[model samples]
Target: MRLERTRREPEAGMAVRTQLPAPPAWMRWLPALFVAALLLVEPFTPVDWPVSFALITVPLLAAFTQGPLGVAAVTVFAVLFEGVLAGTPCCAGRSVGYLWERHYVASYVCTILVGAIGTVLAAHRTRRERTLADVRFVAEIAQRVLLRPVPHRIGNLLLESLYLSAAAEARIGGDLYEAVPTSYGVRLLIGDVRGKGLLAVETAATLLGAFREAAHDEPDLPSLADRVEVSMGRRAMLLGGGEVGERFVTAVFAEIPTEGHLVRIVNCGHPPPLLIRSDEVSELDRGRSAPPLNLGVLVGEPYSVDVYDFRPGDQLLLYTDGITETRDPHGVFYPLLERLRSWGPLPPRELLEQLHGDLMAYSHNGLQDDIAALTACLLADQPAEPAPPSDGAGGSSGAP
Candidate 1:
């Protein structure tokens, strides 16, 4: 078996898209229209009721939709409008100064103060939004580096994976998965760190890095698991800082041979994988299970590898606890096995797509934990036929 370690880079110079939609044309002219209407009515209204107080709405609206400079311009217009209205002829043919009584002066002062405060608020909001955008971009890059995309096809098996972070705004969390084609077979790892945030992310990165390197050097599943445990222990020592209850990771590792009908798995305090056949779905539970990595010191015995049949037309699903532990509004846990029974046999991609949609619908789109799922379909042992080479012109390249 040969290992394919390929990294795909994103297209260069992609632009960031803004989430807030552009303000409507009518909204852009709303402040001007409002001020004009107030001016037209000022001659008819009584001078005792200062109309300038209503002018504050212009800057208030601008604060929500426009930048600081735009809000400042609106504030200046409001103050000028109030001053002009005070001097204009009004009730009983009174002079402009007649409108500037004690109450009128107080109202005029309040309007100017309110507009200034609105401009400052708009500036502060814009700065906060920009900072959030920058942080989100960094989090996305970190997620991509830690959990590289799994290829659609690995060796003879078709693969599919899905990851959903509970923190929708951040778009990333501690859940992780990696599939590597090793000399022994195609080894896979799906794991979840015990906690959330950066600490969990660091532990997940440490686990995946160790798995990718050790999968090739270790002779068997048990030894490979040992390597990961050792790596996690070292990482915990650096991260724990003498804390008593440090973080740990629960994982399920599996190996599918190049030309075999058996799959070997090691369950390290993680949920058991589901084996789906023609008309049956069963959990691949073992008699013995080991403690999660970084907590191996608590166990007296070594990890046990469980073997199960993974024949043609069969699909195996590996997932983190987030899937089974999800609860609906009524506190009902998700019925993974019951739901899979109706899906019948499907391609890895379609199966995951349907499952993800159903899961969201079941939870009303409010999942409390980060979820990671990997599905592997065992294709025929014989190699697939190669397609004909394409002519140089932009013709069809044939089926993949």
Candidate 2:
């Protein structure tokens, strides 16, 4: 079944912002102006000094900041200037045929050789940049499809999410999350695959696909979890290639009822969700847990849903192990609960912003794994504002 009435963040294709402003207009022609100045000074310079050598700088600079055509233009200007100097009475004091003089001939030949090399280098640089741009486009499309943006509001809940991949080159990793509104309630899933790279990404996509489809049809949290587990088993068999037995996912699947102050959770070997109220932070459940999904064969017992009191004004925090396991130079793990005490009940968006900055600082920007965090806050007594219109991207959806 298709998700209904979902709004997602719009994709921005290839728009990159820079901290530095564009160079001033005068800078564009500075190289040509400098070459002209050198040509003018050649006549006045001491006979021992060859000012024509300075003209080489024009083509070298143009190669880095301009295309091959610009470099060729500079090279042509240098050649014409040399010819003028050879024929000028005040300069070389010889006719245009002085271009055949041994010294003048050597200078002209060296200039052409340098310009030719610069042109080839400029062409190669341009091709490499275009290739990188194409790769970035593909990565962005994949990211938008796999980890769709969570809306700012879903039903009566205000939501905020953050995702960071440790591999700076690849903006996507195995961490995953999805929140869908369903006839039963609003169902959510936050998970991390067993490993990294393409295999981990494949497993993550499979789990989310299963959760999105089964979330609405299943009557309860446990049934939904079972359906996902079955789906994962099939994927593991098809993709795992003898390592199927080793694949698994650590996740927390939850349900927030449409008109109640209760939130049910089933932790499948993932970190427990945190409950944050004004100046208070508590772990939702530490009593029991199910095996990581796809490894249900190892656990004889069935998964159990732990129900918690989710009063209005309280925020529920779900995350992958990347947060708790982040270590400092001293090898001590991050103190997540201690830090939350100081945040003082901020809105979901602000809370995540503060947490991400603090986490990066604590780890000294050396995160070793992918991190994904989702915060959901139940609205206060006042009625929630209607959700903004969808960008028509069709993100996951459910019932009010």
Q: What TM-score would every model get versus the actual structure?
A: 0.78, 0.77
- Give the clash count for each candidate: 0, 4
Q: Give per-residue CA lDDT, model 1, range 78-183, as digits (tens).
A: 8777766665665325664645656657766777788888889989878877776777667656766787878889878998888876775655667888899988
What CA RMSD would you report for each candidate? 8.2, 10.2
Off by over 4 Å in 2: 1-61, 77-107, 327-333, 363-365, 383-400
Q: Which stretches in model 1 have alpha-carbon errors above 4 Å? A: 1-52, 76-109, 381-400
Please provide, for model 2 over 227-326, each residue's C-alpha lDDT reduced to its tens digit, 9 standing for 90 to 100: 9999999988877587798889999998999988999999999999999998699998867889999999777678898999999999999999999998
Residue pairs in steric clash, candidate 1?
Answer: none
C-alpha lDDT of residue 315 in model 1:
95
Global CA lDDT computed for model 2 = 0.81
Candidate 2 positional error at 253, Å:
0.9
